[model samples]
Target: MESEDITIKPADKGGGVVILDTKDCVEENLRLLGDTSTYQMLEKDPTLQFMERMRGLLEYGKERGIINEREFKYVRFPRVPVFYHLPKIHKKLQKPPGRPIISGIGSLTANLSEYVEHYLQGLVVCLKSYLKDSIQILNQLSDFKWEEDMFLVTADVTSLYTVIEHLQGCEAIQYSWQCTLF
Candidate 1:
């Protein structure tokens, strides 16, 4: 397949997720949140619902003493994300599916997320440690002890951000803090 007509997605198991026909309809697919039918759902709220939600979250934070006046001042509204896709390098006869990344850069949510990350840094297992660079991982891997007849296996999960159940993951995090021994 031609480069414009094809892309790659990580396999749920071990192979590549190839799209059979890309033809000339890439723009619709690039918007990973949803297709044309979904875009129809985007409508201006006359009641200022989005602002209300933000206000509620901020109020809740203030009540819980989680956010100070200084932090409230620091928050800035985030921009709507821009979407783009990078095609896969290998394989033919299929177009790779692209997923949308909700880039929270320069947004209030991003600031809040970063602030929360500071607290999570002190947790039993830091998410950042698991997401370290390849060099660090390779250096650590050098210390792995192999058994006499051992074989190494590796796998990548597809669409992890979209696939994970967020609420369940939060519960697991709570469980890690409560039941698991560090």
Candidate 2:
């Protein structure tokens, strides 16, 4: 009786590609190098522990006359020592600049609260000083005999916040605070 041939199927469409197992490949390459007498000696010797493989490459290059004594000295000594001693220079010279535009007006108003109170106090003091001078002037003009006849006209600003338009109020507040409102 004749047997049918078996066929293999591919994996799912979205599944990743399969790669070759490199463990055995690397182990075989290491085995080939381990067969040498120098490699065997390097494995036994504690002095040749760190750069055993690099020493083999350097010896091979020297035997091939690809690197001379002078060239190897400069390559392995002077240039490398200079690189170690040099200080690490930063890329950017200075830190980034501050923001180009202002932020919230509310923040500005909040910060100016104390200053505003101080300013109002100063203004009130100045107004009181002026009033005293004006009273003195009026008393002098009235010829020393003080009359009880006094008429004062006073005006009250009602609903100052609500009555003023938002944009105009902001501008006025900014002017009073001596700052730009955002």
Candidate 3:
């Protein structure tokens, strides 16, 4: 791909390199959520609506001395619309039939720093698995005398947290964790 094609114009100074377009990212996220059964649960849970109603009811109940101020102030509930994209697999056909498929998943979490560290750790594990698979494929291909050029490309989102919209970032994290939790 050309430089312009690959380049992602950052929304802010600290944001990392983003090769995939925003729309593509959103689509990929949706696909991941759908594939992993996260989307279904989200659809079933009206979290935002429930929160709004709860807040109103709590406030009203507090006026009637039914609930305390502490309860109202620190009503900790999972926020809706957590933004996290599913892993993206990019397949490059170096040679027609035997191309290797490489995938990278990115998450924009509420706690960016923590998420970055977590993403890095996950990436390491993924890379190890991918490397092992590639080696096996290469060994098998060599034994069969199948001469085909192949390359595996691994990519990462350099700094995701600082750049994404706060709402979207939260959504991404929620979606990502939902998959794991479920």
Tens-place lDDT per residue, model 1, 1-182, is: 35655534443224554453455236535455465533345556333565468768887888899888787666666665444444342433244444444566765467767876776656745543464567987888799987989987778665665656879878867875665445
The residue pairs that clash in candidate 1, if any, are: 7-96, 8-96, 19-95
Look at candidate 3 and tell me the lDDT of residue 107. 19
Per residue, candidate 2 scores C-alpha lDDT tens digits across 86-125 of: 1111221122111111232333233233444565655444
Supply the TM-score for candidate 1: 0.63
Question: Model 1: which ten-residue window has the lowest total lDDT?
Answer: 86-95
- Candidate 3: tens digits of C-alpha lDDT, residues 62-125: 8999766874564554444444532222322121111111222221122333435665555444
Winner of 1 and 2 under TM-score: 1
Flag the better candidate by lDDT, 2 or 3.
3
lDDT of each: 0.58, 0.38, 0.47
Better of 1 and 2 by lDDT: 1
Give residue 179's error in model 3 in angstroms: 29
How much is 161 displaced in model 1, in angstroms? 1.5
Q: Once superposed on the true structure, which residue ranges of model 1 sit more than 4 Å away at CA? A: 1-48, 90-99, 124-131, 179-182
Q: How much is 132 displaced in model 1, in angstroms?
A: 2.0
Give, for candidate 3, the lowest lDDT window spanning 10 residues.
Answer: 93-102
Q: Model 3 TM-score?
A: 0.27
